[model samples]
Target: MSALERRIEAMRLFGRLVATQEGREYLADNNHKSGQAVVVADYEELIKDVMPRIRSHKPPVTIALLKDDELLMFSIGPTPEAERVSSSAASPESTIGMLYEAACQTSNGSSFHLTSWDRDATAFSMPSVRELLSH
Candidate 1:
């Protein structure tokens, strides 16, 4: 697959995962005192191990994953304009954590700040987040 295709696939897998009860529980269990969920996995693990177990795909969404200095962005459907705004501002080192924090703050375990459906009214936003996404 092309890079964009890979990203889309990854996002779809992640969105499905986030929609699961197990996924939400895992995230909640791993959430730090600061409200950031400590989720880390390589691309292969996400695609191979995790994606397979999610039996349902509900509520298509967006997600961002950071590896080293790179930020990978994906959406289940069309890429939303807000996704561009946030991804651009993210510093690779902090993107995942910031996304987790935003998720908690917004009561959205899906990390909607990093990516969400185009029409999602609950998408997270803040000046700092906007700035991080802008970069």
Candidate 2:
């Protein structure tokens, strides 16, 4: 498969997984365990917002995996604009975790990780994540 196809496949796999019962439970359990309320991001909006990047395919989008706001790993995020997740992300990290779980499964259980989708690969160098992603 092409890089774009691979990106789409991964996203679709993740979106499908998160829509399953097990996925919902996993998210709910994480929210319950956190004690602090977590807000679900409007992934649909995010997907729409990043559509231009996907179409041109000039700059490969990058997905960053961060734990407690620290960059852990990164790879190209090449999803197509047409195949967005059916629902908003369960948690900010859900997509990242799903992608990671499906693709990477790095050696660690979920504790605290952050995900940035469709951003420049160097997006995390800023003083704050809010600043990094804002660029």
Candidate 3:
């Protein structure tokens, strides 16, 4: 197989692991060890309200995972909805982290019908301990 094919398969495997953990009770029990962000906001509700705005504005969005103070496993693309908003100005990291949380909630079915403009631009999906676990 070619390098690109291998990379594609790897991504699919990562997605599958995420999907499996996301849908199953076993994964739910294991979620505590994963160190996922303790989201304080009503992300589902927020995403629902903001998605249309994001799509319309087409602001740049970066999908990212925060590993300590550093960002790992990230991807960048346009978020059209963000373009419409009057953001006073926030750090790029803060903005991307917010977007990542929204995307995660949306993908997991907590928030329905609001798809990200660029789901493939993952800032952090590689070498994740949870993703590497044997199912």
Candidate 4:
């Protein structure tokens, strides 16, 4: 296989892993051990409300993940830029809900269980964690 194909497969595999319980456990362990900020936010209601209005925005909506204080855009998103520290998430159809949907489909109906921290430093709510794991 070609290098590009290999990379693509690797990314797909990474997404698949990240969507699983074992992947989550690994991430949680690394986060705790390294003191990294694994930001989680409650976008359930917020995304639902904003999605209708923002679905048609000029730029596509982008959802990023917080890994060790670095912002990595979801590889499955429209732009799919993974090497960046941060990028614009300007969107209409690019709402967090859309990302969640893609993540869901990618994970074969499993939950993303991951969330992004707000642009500003913010704490994730226990309620959000409960809701995420409960699902």
In lDDT terms, which candidate is top? 1
lDDT of 2 by residue, 53-78 (tens): 43344432334333333322223333
Deviating ranges (above 4 Å) for candidate 2? 28-135
lDDT tens per residue, model 3, 1-135: 443343344445434545764523433443222433222112222344434443453333222233232222322233235333322222222343455444444322111122443332222122233434344
State in Å the error of residue 81, model 2. 35
lDDT of each: 0.35, 0.33, 0.34, 0.33
TM-score-based ranking? 1, 2, 3, 4
lDDT by residue (4-87, candidate 4, tens digit) is 343344344335535777656644543322222222222332444443433343323323333222223322212223433334
lDDT of 1: 0.35
Worst 10 residues of 4 by lDDT: 120-129
Lowest lDDT 10-residue stretch of candidate 2: 119-128
> RMSD for each model, in Å, please?
13.4, 17.0, 13.2, 16.3
Question: Which regions of candidate 4 deviate over 4 angstroms?
Answer: 1-33, 45-94, 107-135
Lowest-scoring 10 consecutive residues by lDDT in candidate 1?
A: 121-130
Better of 1 and 2 by TM-score: 1
